[model samples]
Target: MTPEQVMNIAYQGMRVTLLLGGPLLITALATGLLVSLFQAATQINEMTLSFIPKILAVFAVLVLTGPWLLKLITNYTIELFSNIPAMIT
Candidate 1:
């Protein structure tokens, strides 16, 4: 494969990775921020206080988005695999 083709594939892989991970990361970030704000407002400074909510939020996000995320990744993988023979020659 040419350098350009390799780079293109790498770029696509990164894009796919980011797309797959973006929601969970964003959810965690938002949850953490909200938890922090709540802690500040209520003066409850327990270190573990943030863990459960963030976990639940991420879990909920995963539950909600899992199928769509799976379909997206599966389609990308199928497309990449389908092009393998062409890429080889």
Candidate 2:
């Protein structure tokens, strides 16, 4: 495979990875921040509060977006696998 083809494959793989992971991570981060703020305001500094909220929010997001996420991943995988012969040449 040429350098250009290799870079293209790497770039596409990275894009797929980020797309798959970004939403869940972003939701978790937002949930954590909101929970932290709430805990601070209420003076309820429970050490585990933030973690639970983040986990729940991330799980909820995954459930809601699962089909779409799966479709995207499947498409990316098919595209990559289909290109194997072209890439090798």
Candidate 3:
């Protein structure tokens, strides 16, 4: 493949990866921040306090977005595979 094609492929891969991972990561970050704020307000300094909520939030986000994420990745993979023969020639 040409340099431009290679770049396109890499960019698409990154996009897919980000799409798949961004939500749960963002949720975890938000959960951690909120937990920190709560702890500060209540004067309860518990280091492990954020873990369960973050895990639950990420799990919920994953479950909610799972189908959409799968669809996105499946479509990208299908498109890539469909073009492979053309790309080879």
Best by lDDT: 1
Score each candidate by Cα lDDT.
0.97, 0.90, 0.94
Give the number of the best model, judged by TM-score. 1
Ranking by TM-score: 1, 2, 3
Better of 2 and 3 by TM-score: 2
Worst 10 residues of 3 by lDDT: 1-10
Model 3 global lDDT (CA atoms, 0 to 1): 0.94
Report the lDDT tens digits of candidate 3 across residue range 1-89.
Answer: 78888899999999999999899899999999999999999999889999999999999999999999999999999999998997887
TM-score of each: 0.96, 0.94, 0.92
lDDT of 1 by residue, 37-70 (tens): 9999999999999999999999999999999999
lDDT of 2 by residue, 1-89 (tens): 89999899889889989989999999988998899889889999798879878888899999999999999999999998998888877
- Model 1 misses residue 25 by how many Å? 0.3
Candidate 1: what lDDT? 0.97
What local lDDT score does residue 44 receive in model 3, on the 0 to 100 scale?
Answer: 97
Q: Which pairs of residues clash in candidate 3, taking residues 3 or more apart in a chain or in different chains?
A: none
Displacement of residue 16 (Cα, Å) in model 1 is 0.6
